[model samples]
Target: MKYDSLARDIIRHVGGKENVIDVVHCVTRLRFRLKDEGKADTERLKAMDGVVTVIQSGGQYQVVIGNQVAEVYDAVLEAGGFGNAVSQEEKPEQKGGLMSRLIDIVSGLFTPVLGVLAATGMIKGLTGMLAALGILSTASGTYQLLYIIGDSMFYFLPMYLGFTAAKKFKLNEFVGMTIGACLVYPSLTAIMAGEPLFKVMEGTILQSPVHLKFLGLPVLLMRYSSSVIPVIIAVYFAARLQNRIKKILPDVVKGFLTPCITLLIIVPATFLVIGPVATWMSQIVGAVTMAIYGLSPMAAGFLLGGTWQLLVMFGLHWGMAPVGLNNLVTYGYDAVTVLKSATPIVTACVVLAVALRTKDKKMKGICWPACISSLFGVSEPSIYGVTLPLKRPFIITLLCSALGGVIMGAFQTKAFMAGGMGIFSIPSYINPETGIDGSLYGYLLAIVISGGLGFILTWFFGLSPEKKEDSASSSASDIVINSPLRGRVIPLDQVEDEAFSCGVMGMGAAVIPSEGRVHAPVDGVVTALFPTLHAIGITSDEGVEILIHIGMDTVKLNGDGFKAHAAQGDRVRKGQLLVEFDMEKIKQAGYSLTTPVIISNTPAYQAVTVLAQTGDGAGTENGAKISCEDGLLCISTC
Candidate 1:
């Protein structure tokens, strides 16, 4: 919740606010556009509080903050500035780069739509399931009411596009919406319906043709409901037109004239050229997709199912949405059938693996909700919190997905509707004329085979080291405490904050007195000292890695006032110093000194514990000790 301070520290740590170009947010990450990627302090940011992880992907420096990303994004904006203007200018010019620009434009257009699209998709999926299970009947009032819940959004999709386009193009949103509304107006829809209003003979109207024109140019009437491209183009042009007009027009006249002129030009042009062109292009895309589906259903299935996860990883899956929607609109079904079957199977596999591999009660508790959410077609929890962290499970799940996709493709399975990937998507697979007996069997079989095989494989091989280690009876005498700091002992859990409340970060007695100094807690070798110097890892003679982390967000200082006493691979003794810092200077620089003494090699430990309070003084017999039982100085205490 208090990520403002952390964000400020991160910006300053990564070469200061001037180095940042722009900051934006996705569902769970703060994506930054930096002037120079090389100057980023990745390790330092990772060590900060409230940061779940950090990733550099798709030319973006992504700081993952989980559910609280909006808060972090606000904090980042306050610390840095708005817009990616700096980064944009710093970007190198490319030759004949239309393709790259197109890709960027398309990605930007769809980014904000992804969340709503996914939600609507899930809702549609659920409606199908309810109808299928007899809980709701197609002819019933209840079913009709619920159907509207999911269908209205898609039916008025042009409006959604207009809003998103306005945001993307930095235009007036209401104006965009008005333009979209005009295209979908009841009268326009009625005119576009059935057949041509009239056949022109020598450019003369017969039976009063419903032709719309601007300045003598005939406008081509095309349906805009559920359409994607035309409204976006209209809004983009409208924004530019409005801006240009506003610059020269008097303020009193500008307000009314801008909208009047924008709509007049945009609406006619949209119908005359933009609408027709976009429709033709969409048709081509749809045809191409159908052709691919017809060529090899299994191949298409395998590719879609196997690569869907990868697309999701890069946030590029929204590019395929038009295809799915086009299929639904054109043929009332989708031939790319593997996703619904493969996604659930892959999710089930990961959930099963995590359930069996982890022994940590807290972790297990978290995984359960993630697994349940996945069953409903939400994979974020599983992807970020479970599978990705475990490594092997994620790969295995993907492999299984590919296998399942191939089977579905071989069957030439098709979904007769557009919906989310889950059990609820079964209705989309339904052949209504033949009832539930059509493609339903094949889909069910695919799910069982892929999920069952994946689950069994992971159960046997996915066990984590932390689960197998003994924790209830390990002894501190067998373990060695490698000093993370060289300063004098200050006692246990001293500094401040909830991070040190239950020793969640680590376990050990706290230290103070010296000027932010770090020393070897035991005779061991330094295995890793992060580039940011926020934390260090030392492997003791007993083969346990002791991690010493300085104050929270201290990494944001970017090694400014701290100096490392040793380098990687250095051998040191219990009292050998590792790093020295100006504690007073660091505190004044705005960093919390609630240090954590963690066991980086948690797998090697049976248990670790914190003993005594801050004033209890170190080196005393009353201080903490690692043991098997739950006591103030025992292992079970953790």
Candidate 2:
């Protein structure tokens, strides 16, 4: 319900359900893979209610929806006839370069869990702060309990990564989790503790070999708790192996046998081959990262800090996930953690500047919540809703982050534990053994620099370079009612039902649906939902009342074929999915499939406008199809 209408409108405007190749939502945007971007009415979308901006970037037609994108995503799923929409990410077209495809996979895998990751990180940071302040102690039960709670997510990182990897690769999730479990099994740890029965060459990859063998080849056993790369590689192979197994297996045994054969082949392959190779590659990545930092910490820091947010915008941040995790696993701390920690705070400060500077009341309302959300380490709301829309504040925040990195690098900062971004993660910068070390002080100084710079620079120069106008004014002035069905529009007077045809109920167009669904024509609250489910009442925010009656005298069917997804008093949006029905059932029951979309208060309006059929064949029913993107009518007042 949160973004019910926005979701529906976005889906339709992006060329309806047919044009979408797939849809995914990041923190503040609905990212769509569309068959053709040209089909979308971009200007209309930009002017629509509830949309922040329509940005076409990174091979995604992204509709900015502020913080409630997940809800909108669910609504889009229902509207598009998809249930449980977040299973496998849409595979990008292979025609693209490898880099784009890689980015697609990485972004898709990481996007769903990022919120929880940040939340758990914040908890860990707070618990550390409590211990540092002496309110909690190492030996206390409360501290121990909270500590376990905070650390569980990181320790079990591989399992989460495994689930995402399997889904991304289109393999069974349980099988992927099983592979992840094997990597970190207590048995593997016990075996690794004894001695290497055999070893690889000393200095190269898999230098310290293990005694265990998988089908006779020596297995290189390594700790897999908090691992990121090994499980992903294992699942990728498992996905391919499972798909192959399905081809040869009979239908009766396919479900269980696919798992059996795939895991049998994959487990040993993972233990003997993929695990060691990927772990070794991850090690090299960590070493390369440190080597760069070793050259000049400040310069490396400046580069990463300044561009990290930019890279995040393009989903390039996932490339660094393994490197950071590897660093933490190898050295018990990481520079990348400290290098990027100040970003959210910098973003938060820039938003505060916009909130202070904007004359538009609607813009002010958007900025404050976004700024507060940024403090908790989610910056997309601030980025898309406030700063990015304004345009200038984004530049200020990046400059602040770069300066912040310089100060942090001078202290040779490192995070002793995993945590979220922002002031809440300050304790992560503190050394676990020493507590409140020079690096923690350095982090504090960096935050001060970042927040202070963002505030001052943005206060002076952050007004949008683009001409400013009240977007809400446009919303208030125009009420464009879109078609509520995929159907042929016919004048209301031609309908056989006298209640609708003779203007007894109201004046509006009637549609004989080509599809079995009903959608909202405007942004409104559901004033009524009939018990019979044959009709619905929606009162638009602009004070226009609409009654959508489905089929002629179809109430006799008594909700048999009609499935209602919305209810009375729920606010809805233009093109949002409202009800679905079996059109064939209605026709079989001797009822017409024609639906009337009536403005119930016709006398209150100055004029009502419906589109005349304007297609190649004159006066044909299917000649010009009316959809949500094309107007059903214009509600006008003199």
Candidate 3:
């Protein structure tokens, strides 16, 4: 419950628990699929504390929560009444085009294991570096143990993919895992390596040695270890197959019978058809990618590296992960993806430059942490929080990273294994057989020049004096909170309750209501409406949050004298009647009709000025009558 408040706020702002169709988390974000994206308050979420930023892309509402995203994700599940298992029935109707859905599906499948994947990759890379450096002998038992720990995930990647893919496709997870286990079964792998009975598809890319016979059909076995696409396709097929089997079988026998029938059909079908096709497709993709990279390595590097962060911003970065893994499996080492190894370092350098030059304390604070995180290969914070908000610096990062990519590509740098990110990934360049090679040196040199130049260029050219770009961009207009009640305007401090009077809730003017109607203060959605109808919260379309409390300690009356005209999540225009109360009835009930209208999220704004009072005088003093049409408060974002 450490993040309980943040969790509740997130759920509320994301159109409540009912709006969420499904939710998943990655390294640093909580990705939600909502039934209606329109109900979400994007600006309100962006202004929230503990959230790094909010992104809507690839058919997802992604809330970036820095490194604590996992804990926050757990809290969100608990708070939103969600079970750990994802249900296919819960998924919203698909929106967006093919690309968007692909990105969503791919990210979801990979996100669950990304953290541990990176960790294991790092461990393997480090051990490889140690072995190459002669710090540990490859024959050493300690080395063997460490390698096994690090390598097991990659070796049995098909099974992991099966488990995750089954969840994504809504199949029984264990059934998919069983299919994967069958693909990588030790005996099957050994058979694939043995002498073939005959060769089939003799003269084409599809040509393969027939390894074994499956009920008289020639089985074309594929090396499933460390592979990507085959298991995913197989699992999808198994999921569909299982669903079909369940429909035919009766409930009494279906529990065990469904899987038994599914496996019998899918396992052989996979080895005979799905495996060969997917493996060929993966090989074709790898071949095409390598050929493209081989044509002009630097150009490929420049394009991919420059746009890498942009892809990360939209969560499309996962698309390239499969390709990289395919290359690692098809070819022993990957030369293409290794070109982007310097991108994080480049981002780190750029943010460091921003931290050094920015006059704003907040930007400086954000930059320092972002810079540190980027150095460790988590650049989402730097990209979304620090640089992307300041357009010039973000552009500088891309250009620098592109140049770094060009340099690395020119040297033909390659990654022998799926390594760690940022600095820890350096060891992935070390040749397993040779000590330090030109590739590793070339990578080191590329990062140095690229990162150093990034700092220089960003410091000198990325910012302007006063760092006014952000302020200028946000200067479209000030948000005006109109008076929500016909009453005598009074200073908040003069109110009876200390919570509102002392500005403990937020800063805003109060009113002594002459009438009982409460109107919408701005064009916005009603975010919160208390059951007692004595209080309401509205976040304006432009992101100012306003709270109107009917009276001090009014909860005792419950819904006695209060009536709601608008419910929570209702979209209302300025001056629209939201709530009505009987003033005489409240007065007779002995409750003070002192209403405090406040900006609930005051800290996100630069200033909250009480506009001039009306009727009696134009100054912001007490005892001035104000109408619902009058401008009561002006909020400035920058």
Candidate 4:
């Protein structure tokens, strides 16, 4: 995917690789945090191929690349070099901001594991439902075996989070994992279950409290295991401490002595001070949540349920997960019942709406698989394919889910067991001791109402636009080209060693000359010329804006070794020389020469096709003809 090159080029285009403080990607876009947004060339990038769109939103410079984003991301990485070079670490000044740092830390820790995490969550949710329905008994062998499948990942969550946090903090992950392992150790858990090790006397551990006289203070007890905030905070300090210790300790005993001291200081501090404080803080947060839930269950449910998906969209949902886990550990049940109920109901509605609305045979066939996946709580397919495309369906789904959540909250429906949401989440809501008669009915009603409402609303309001037939008579007869360069007509893709595979960049072809001089392809005025002199934009007599980009990342060179033959707003004729470049100088300077010729006004064209390929008896040209393979890119039929 040549992500490194792509990343470098993108960074250079935005400003420079150095100007970027951080880089991350969601499903379809590369999100960059730039040092200075003023240096970016957003318009030039928008005109490039494989780019769906360019957006600057929410303090993010986003480049959308559709489905092949991973490929582009890889290319960007390859070009930018590996490790902290293009990372958030480069901007220490901004790290002081709490929300920014938190977002950075959470994104780094959770983004990589989100797919597996979501899958395991759904699996656990489903298992609970089966158990509640009596389809699988808790004592059954199958239930016991499946329990491990879903529970193992979460039971060891701190271990996974430790590794990710280590990476985010730029610390040794192995060292962090070692600390995490100690916290979750069976021995520590057993010890914490027993009495305090010693009584505090004058800031020291002693056999009796009679000696407590120094500053009139008593010592503290130390305990560990199943504690969250303390271990994370301890590791953060440990990482810094380890770095400092290595520099001061003598080489002979440094290795073992350093670790021993670290453990002695960190472990006690964690247990005696950090652990208790963090635990107390968590209790406070839980208390606040309880108060909210108690005040208006319906409002709490509606707020959390309706916004759960929105939180997921921004990747902030992980922030709430620890709260849920804390509830399960402390109170044995989370008040946030809407998380489980809302996801499945919304997903089911989206799938149903997609199935009902889509008319294209190919899309209809794809919808079946998408719908099945949604049932299993994999909603990306349904979201992107069905709901997002058919906008109103998504809105309807969100509304219905919120209504259902309100209903569930009003009933004070609580899951007796801790688990995930969805149809499979039914079991978690069941009170085994009381059978399924308690609040199980409310849970069932929520799901039915939400899913039913979403489907019915979408079915009535959503309509898929019909595909238009192509006009066979409208061909590539309008394009008349004068040579952009006087070199022999060689296959555009076959131009020596090129950047694009062949000359096909997106939906057009380019002319590769023996030299780097660029002549006008048709009579037009120069509309734009980049400061780098590597790209030029010209509007032809026929109103086609042809963009000619000389090489990849050439903009970084900043106009070196190239001269513009024409100024912006200057009219040019076919074969009129535009830009002259030193090909040998550029090559020796380590820059690519594979230029891209793109039709900037692509949306206005009915269709674009490449005609340079020969099957049996067609003569090849230097460039390919651009026309529609299926039909026009855009059209108005009479």
Q: Among these predicted structures, which one has the highest TM-score? A: 2
Q: Which ten contiguous residues of candidate 1 have the minimum total lDDT?
A: 86-95
- Can you tell me which runs of candidate 4 are displaced by over 4 Å? 1-130, 133-136, 140-142, 164-170, 179-183, 186-281, 303-403, 412-441, 451-550, 553-594, 597-638
Candidate 3 per-residue lDDT, tens place, 397-437, comes to 99999999889888888888885668768878888888688
Model 3: residues with Cα > 4 Å off, grouped in runs: 1-94, 110-115, 203-206, 226-229, 285-405, 409-442, 448-638
| Model 1 TM-score, 2 decimals | 0.45
The C-alpha TM-scores of every prediction are 0.45, 0.50, 0.47, 0.46
What lDDT tens digits, residue by residue, belong to model 2 across residues 26-144?
Answer: 43457788999999989888888767677785567877664345567878887787543551113322223564444345444655665565455556656766666678886899988
Best of the candidates, lDDT: 3
Tens-digit lDDT track of model 1 for 1-638: 37778878878766687776677654345667788988988888888887766777656777766545556676776667653222111111221256445334443454455455445545555676677677887899977876677656656766766876776676667788888788778797666555664443334211123355557665556555555556767788888988898898898897688888888888777777764454444444334444666787766666667766655543234446667777678876665634436675567567766775654444475566656556656555465455644546667777778777777766666687665457656666788666675366667777778887778767776542331223454543444353454334444455453334334434555544345667676665665565556667666554655667677656556667777777554556667777777788788987766565665445345666544433324343334332212112223312
Q: What is the Cα root-mean-square deviation between model 3 and the actual structure?
A: 13.6
By lDDT rank, best first, the candidates go 3, 2, 1, 4
Prediction 4 global C-alpha lDDT: 0.58
Locate the minimum summed-lDDT window of 10 residues in model 4: 628-637
TM-score of 2: 0.50
Clashing pairs in 3: none
